[model samples]
Target: MPSLDTAKAYYEYFNQKNWDGMISLLHPEVRHEPNQGEPRIGLELFKAFMQHMDESYEETLTDMVFFTEPNDERVAVEFVVNGIYKKAEEGLPAAHNQKYVLPAAAFLGFTDGKISRITTYYNLPLWIKLVSE
Candidate 1:
């Protein structure tokens, strides 16, 4: 699949909460960079992070647009995140099923049809404020 297709598929998997499907598209040494944290390497760490996210929040991506490099090795995605904070995460405001909507973006790198890196960005303060309200 093309890089844009791969990114769309990943997001589709995420929207369905299909962790396995998402992971299947990733390289064994995939690097994941969260919004405002250190990068986490490896599929195992990614899986753990996904599990934590699943436990703490419920989210869906909407209004998505994907862009790809000429070589098709990189894909950039812009979307809106609609989410409900289900559980409290460390160093974050307490969750009480709070709903939030925010713009977000992700940059994905592909190698041999597998995603090698995923770096996501969003407004952390805005998200926190929305959920806290």
Candidate 2:
């Protein structure tokens, strides 16, 4: 459990669209659940998930802030993520080439200086409304 530096680095990696680079900051057995669709466990699956996101949207997290829990073992991040879909996103309400900005929250759990688990939640209705507009 470090400080905001590590957390900021993680976001920077994501913002840069560096999927593989971000993977290096996770543990081998890291687990990720994005808005409860399905849990992706292990480094390979997590990388795959990021790859899917990279392929689906041109997005960035703006106005982001991180709140680290006690001992810095967990972090709660709040941000507004904006994306323009070039390829249809898996759960999107529309076909393609849509733009969206959604408020999102994510919990990150860490161990041994890397992320062990992450859970993300977002406003679905807001996402739909924006992307489908």
| TM-score of every model versus the real structure | 0.98, 0.91
Q: What is the lDDT of residue 92 in candidate 2?
A: 59
Q: lDDT: which candidate is best?
A: 1
Candidate 1 lDDT over 9-91, as tens digits, reads 99999999999999999999999989887999999999999999999999999999998879999999999999999999889
For candidate 1, the TM-score is 0.98
For model 2, what is the C-alpha lDDT against the true structure?
0.82
| Superposed model 2: Cα runs more than 4 Å off | 1-3
Compared with the true structure, what per-residue lDDT tens digits does model 2 show for residues 1-133?
3846677888998998777667878889998988957898998888777777777779899999899866878888999988887776556575577877788988888888988888999987777788777
Q: Please state every model's RMSD to the true fold in angstroms.
A: 0.7, 1.6
lDDT to native, each model: 0.94, 0.82
Ten consecutive residues with minimal summed lDDT in candidate 1?
1-10
